[model samples]
Target chain A: MPNNALLLDGTKVAESIKETLKERIQALGEKGIVPCLATVLVGSDPSSATYVRMKGNACRRLGIGSRRVVLPENTTTEELVETIRELNEDPAVHGILLQHPVPASIDEREAFEAISIEKDVDGVTTLGYARTAFGLADFPSCTPAAILAIMKHYRIEAEGKHAVVIGRSPILGKPVSAMLLNENATVTTCHSRTRGLPDLVRLADIVVAAVGRPRFVQGDWLKPGAVVLDAGYNPGNVGDVDYEACLGKASAITPVPAGVGPVTIATLLKHTVEAAEKYGNR
Target chain B: MPNNALLLDGTKVAESIKETLKERIQALGEKGIVPCLATVLVGSDPSSATYVRMKGNACRRLGIGSRRVVLPENTTTEELVETIRELNEDPAVHGILLQHPVPASIDEREAFEAISIEKDVDGVTTLGYARTAFGLADFPSCTPAAILAIMKHYRIEAEGKHAVVIGRSPILGKPVSAMLLNENATVTTCHSRTRGLPDLVRLADIVVAAVGRPRFVQGDWLKPGAVVLDAGYNPGNVGDVDYEACLGKASAITPVPAGVGPVTIATLLKHTVEAAEKYGNR
Candidate 1:
């Protein structure tokens, strides 16, 4: 049988998104407003540092100002919140992104909640999450927004589709489920506690893998020609679904390195520019 | 055939919950504290007024103080918000309930969002909704909380259950779905936009009807031996599901008038007492 699967090109979609953002950023520049994103990192986690650096580089490429706040390993929640409040008060900063996995001892949720709702460009705040669920959010969690952007770019309709979301993390799985539900999709959220996982996956017209396990979804588990979105970027350039295996069964699929990741960074940059626009106008 | 269905007695569960609240209310009284609930009612909507009054009477029965802030038909969103802010500032008022359908002219969501999170016992605030979604809320929206309270009272575990929730109203359908998902249930949220609703409902081990249409859910739509929760209260005492029809198919079911409604009011009282307990001690 001939290979007929269409690769959902997220990298190309991300480039188109960035192109539009470039014009918006220029308009903000003309208005004497530089869209600024402040990233706060706690402790010395190497991977976290790399993510922060990548985000900062994305902002720079878009001609947006970037601020990095690094705290010591033992920084308390109170200290982290205080730093966020400072960034919130700074007129120059329009958006705040607090890198997750902030020291295990520290209260991470509290720190995330401390970011001002208006400046929560990463959509980490509880208020922001609620807004996103209600279909009233402008800047939802980046990865979920990126997923939607990809689908929109491809003109894939979610209405009336049975979308099985494998994961329920507040940031990735839950928000994306809410987004799809709002877009008129019948959404089922399955997690680690879910039983008969393969059976549930087989029922889906659309499959989203955000369960964090590398290549966890088997090709045999999917309904033939189902649209698969692998949001999980695991080690060794792999994703939640076996790429080669899914290529045979999936009508459309997102590859790991170029899929979801680039679009996610682009969505973040887009949100920062939007935040600055809203701020400048206000 | 003999009906093998279990009637999930919500009234009995409510009585049990109130019995516990009575003791807590008495303890607060010893400390010279009365758990006060302030209800903000805008305009002269007859049904809305009745709901507010019923809630007030329930508070009185529990020995909690009740304050009614009734505004004229011409009240603006600003005035409604001001009234709620006064309740928030009043140390005597531990909880606030804003009756919905507050004139189509006013921004209902904005007014609900004005209620302080601590005093939002009815759980209408965006922050409260988000908190409930994350399983970190003290007081979730009353109807959804009541549904869970009844389920817990009967020791019906939600974990690993395939629960299908009909309707997507923020207060009832959406929150209940989130609560069930947090309980480790594989939850599917469906709404008016959902296609093949009957097929989706048939896949559930548990079904929640919040569609607001009278007798909309037929018995054949349910999986045999499913646990059904009817959260809808339509005019003429009719519920979303045809009660007699569902009784044949469901292993457990909550009836209309005697089920979720009474428990919902009782849950509001419980939340008020809880808020008072938290406040009085602080």
Candidate 2:
């Protein structure tokens, strides 16, 4: 939709990453290690089911084993915790992802706490979030990890650059801000509560749109030569940024359908392989 | 040292806080709550010794209990960890503070990790840092807490404001940035590694100087009517801001010596009282 904009090819990058994951998974298999990811679906949310299926397909293509554990729609908090505990103790399961936005009655934090830090490949556990935020040694959330991978793939050095992240969600914006800070970039996180959002966006050398509002960031808010990473995938194949307006204004920008989305699954597979390598050794 | 600059009245603020602490400590004592602070000093640095002494004197005047544990110059890492562990287990000690920048041979991170979260009144523990950074409910670091307290005292609402923090240290810059963000202010943290620092400062509604450089922020860098919180207490009683140049430019500014310094100690005392209330109940 955008003209003269260097499209960030997440599909191409993700494919290359899958190729690498395939080799890693194969090597693990040769060593009698099966890289396995356990997806725990508490309720039958259609979108979550679709996401889990996509992850499972990606795992199958990479020769990584995946276990899908679907619970009833009316599962209790204690039951979910017990299920997560079982996965944590399962030697065959290397990493675990409990689909987010579970039933309101379920204590999601308590459920996430049930997953052992070693098996928390989804990076939703308190330990994972803490380590990621503190820039300590640990696995990051898959989406944030995907963003990092994209940055690394493009050789977009964050050091000494101004990175403006338009969101402050636990899994995406906050973690990404910490990651960018760790890379020595002067990071600023803007959210709905933020004042003068457009002014902040216009000053960024790198703009990350993760606010989940479709086309919230306009082309006029972008700084020329800024690298734009659209992490928001709203309904109707819309992104948080106006891609068409950002054309020629941004030096590089990720497209809605193919950008960021494919990489999310690829990074999940990479984490699975890593988890297997570490846990399988034990 | 600069001429005709806006003076941050740190001395006056510190005096005011000291008076309040005196009253609070007396009232707590009347209610049989003896607030105790444990200062674990490692490898006696002269400046650190003086600071510890100041805290001890403040505690004495406020009727708060103070314990000074002085370690040998050649103390080992294991010895310091063991010392902190003992203090953490001590029921009588409400707060534990290991004077920062311990000997080059000793690992400060290990020492900080040894203190229990409940007893971490100075809020330097990994748990404290992580909770504050992630916007999770927890005690903030002393300086950041003091900054928030000062803002509250002045009735300066941070919500929907642009806060520029000119530093990025884990204890000061990063923590304060996180606190400002938690208060719903759009926070931008600048450091020696940051580019376009002056431009960022000019856009801030609130400017926090914590870079420890004397008069680093020029008057021209400030926006008119911006609230300036000078956390920089440089040698010779100078601040990071060009106080003279900002005299008429700022809506309100904290003066050096009395601005953030006194509030920091007061906040430390406040946490000490809280720790006592929590741990004492336990």
Candidate 3:
């Protein structure tokens, strides 16, 4: 019944993860391995460009090598897949990240599958998905993994709790639900087609708002003591959950910009470092 | 609600599917393309052997070829994977089934992944799982696909319905939950870790009992007039749901022996014929 809800500061956690990765990167350097990440961007959409650049910045900040491959908007799926294959074969590239929302002309799933599972640091490949579902993940979907990392950092218990995950996007909603299930949380995955959505949301002990629609989940939809993790990064700095209203009801909440976003980038970089260490040892 | 719930007859449905596949097989026979399924069974587990035999019998009844590779109980993971690889490369083999519960000595996942996604008739491979999740499945996990087939045949509306899937096993609980979500059903997947299990189950319009524990899901857990699909095939013809109790409460229900079991074999055979047709054109 506390008036002030605890904030899950993802920026602070991401920074802490990056610091740990810096030491690991330096150790790899001593062994003649420069932990390298290759990022593929198919179009020039401003937001996608920003995300790609942000990832490059994170890699550089951790002393890891970064390669950005920007393809023309008219690039064919085969061409993009070929480029990823080259990255897969390159000894220096320990990890591969494909910027999402590729042009409509391209088959994104095909392109994602082309990234070698071994170097799938962004965890976009089907193989990685299966591994994550089975709890043997080497590189899980970054955003979901980041959310779990935040929860773990705060000692949040998922066991014997009901988690409502809105949206069913393969990388975010679906993967996160599986991750939560692996942690022993009863997971309900709701989408646009779900009926009585508010009723389902109210039953959750923990609510994760991942649907892209801005402020789609209202405060009154949540159980009073529910823990909220907002993974949406909508335009104008808004999230799926109305933060102002949720702050008054939820026990804990993650703010949009400073929450899942920063930690996602951190997880991608951390996986890159781990991939480098594994690939080097092999 | 009627006291007599309509039994979802899997044996009858399986027969109907097989009759349709029979003509397809005859057409392929004239074109010199004999649809062949290769089943790899490791160890002498009696139940596993029986299941494999049933699948082979189904294929034979449909005029499709079946190849059985029986590996020793002590077969190493590499050896079993090699067998699957050969089956994958064989031109005659249109489908591959690796009987479940492969001796504990083998890394089952590694063995399952070795079956090419093209020939994963039983839908045990990770690629098949990914495809099933994305709704572009060539061959989905047979048991789950069979459940959907039964639901569809009976005109059970999945869209906009709340579905509670009780279990999280890779082939059954997890895959079926994904299938339901793809059909636009709001899906809640629960297992032993779930809190307030009965309460969640009561909210569901459709309840899938796949937990494998005999009569684990009590009838009282279901909402009145809910449709129930019991996928567990335990000894003595017991199922995950307490069938005797559920019959009075459910609008429709699948009986233990005459339900998911027969339809599962039918789906495997159906996929085999489809795979042959696709592979032949290629």
lDDT of 1 at B52: 94
Candidate 1 collision pairs:
none
Off by over 4 Å in 1: A1-3
How would you order the candidates by lDDT, starting with the best? Answer: 1, 3, 2
Q: Against the unseen true structure, what C-alpha lDDT does each candidate score?
A: 0.91, 0.84, 0.91
lDDT of 3 at B95: 92
lDDT of 1 by residue, B16-50 (tens): 98999988999999998999999888899889999
Output the better candidate (2/3) by lDDT.
3
The total number of steric clashes, by the backbone 3 Å criterion, in model 1 comes to 0
DockQ of 1: 0.86
Clash pairs, candidate 3, are none
Instruction: Please identify model 3 stretches exceeding 4 Å from their true place.
Output: none
- Residues B1-282, model 2: lDDT tens digits: 322434446565556666766766666667677889999888768988988988888777777799999998899999999999888787788899899889999988778878888888888876687678666645679999888888877788999999999887767887898889889999887888998888889989999999999998898998888889988988888989887778678888888777888888877777787777666723
lDDT of 3 by residue, A1-282 (tens): 648678999999898898888778889999999999898999899999998999999888778899999999999999999999999889989999999999999999999999988899998887788788878889999999999999998899999999999989989998999999999999999999998999999999999999999998998898898999999999888889999888988999999889989999999999999999888734
Q: Per-residue CA lDDT of candidate 1, range A129-230, in tens?
A: 999999999789999999999989988899999999999998999999999999999999999999999999998989999999999999899889899999
Docking class of 1: high
| Each candidate's fnat | 0.87, 0.72, 0.89
Enumerate the chain B TM-scores of all models: 0.98, 0.91, 0.98
| True lDDT of residue A165, candidate 1 | 98
User: Lowest summed-lDDT stretch of 10 residues in model 1 chain B?
Assistant: B1-10
- State the lDDT at B81 in candidate 3: 88
